[model samples]
Target: MAEFPRTDVFSGPKKTIKTPAWEPGYIRDSKSGKPREIPIIKQLYDVLMKLPRDTEKVFTVPKITLVRYFQKALEGANIQDFRFHDLRHTFASHFIMKTRDLPALQKILGHYSPVMTQRYAHLTNGHIRAEMEILSAVWTPIWTPSEKSVPCEVQKSFVK
Candidate 1:
């Protein structure tokens, strides 16, 4: 599943990671069983452009080797219990929080069903806290009466 995308896949600003129809592997379209095109940002496009393209594939190393390298990087950084697949979860959570668009996220994640994308789109604690803060404006009183002052009618209306 960790197929390093081919250099040929890059078209202009976007780098679409789709399996070819004739030579297919993991990239499966849930609806058409072909492939989906996901757009890559300009930053990523620039970074990928800088890489040396000696081979047809963008990455020179094998898939397994890249996984090993990722694992090594995790160990070096003292990160624990993190997997490559976890990146999808992290991306989904941040994307949803930032964009607040589930449908857009589903398309980006290539989820055939919205349910699958929902599984990944978890709201972080900070994001939830930020959302709750929006309620403050609604609850705020337009005019706060003076605590020390009392109306004359109320004083007169009071029974001994």
Candidate 2:
């Protein structure tokens, strides 16, 4: 297998957004009772850290405010109709292209089934084709001509 060069640098914010002690019960856990961890991007962390802390409110800002902020950011970047959820899609798409480990990717993405990872399988067509080529070489068949066989003589007349 060919080795790929590592790309991309994580050089965003140094700030951290503290989650409130009490969150809505429904959003507390996934179906499997595992807690969901929201990754804090550097830009988002910087913005969040600058905001005044609100002890009274369980959440720092309303969902509408977050959506508006994301929309405005997308508009500024000249990206059309981009939503925050699209970030997850983008991560999955890029990861699939670079890595062949679907199970590990599925776990990282919190997908219940590896089948969910199949959506990105088409992105690694080059890798898949290369794998097929290797397999085809290993499993190639060898054919040889067969020798003619003599017919067996019947001895049924004496028995009758």
lDDT of 1 by residue, 1-120 (tens): 123544357788988765332112222333454467556566665666567766544456887998999999999999999998899999999999999999999988888799999999
The number of the candidate with the highest lDDT is 1
Clashes of 2: 1
Candidate 1 clash figure, as a count: 0
Of the candidates shown, which would achieve the greatest TM-score relative to the real structure? 1
lDDT of the structure predicted as candidate 2: 0.59
Q: Please report, as a residue range, the 10-residue window in candidate 2 with the lowest summed lDDT.
A: 149-158
Model 2 CA deviation exceeding 4 Å by range: 1-59, 120-160
RMSD of 2: 15.0
lDDT of 2 by residue, 7-109 (tens): 3445576545544433323123344657764343456555544557645333478879988998888888899966787777777777776776787678766
What is candidate 2's CA lDDT for residue 54?
A: 47
- Can you give the lDDT of residue 90 in candidate 1? 95
Clashing pairs in 1: none
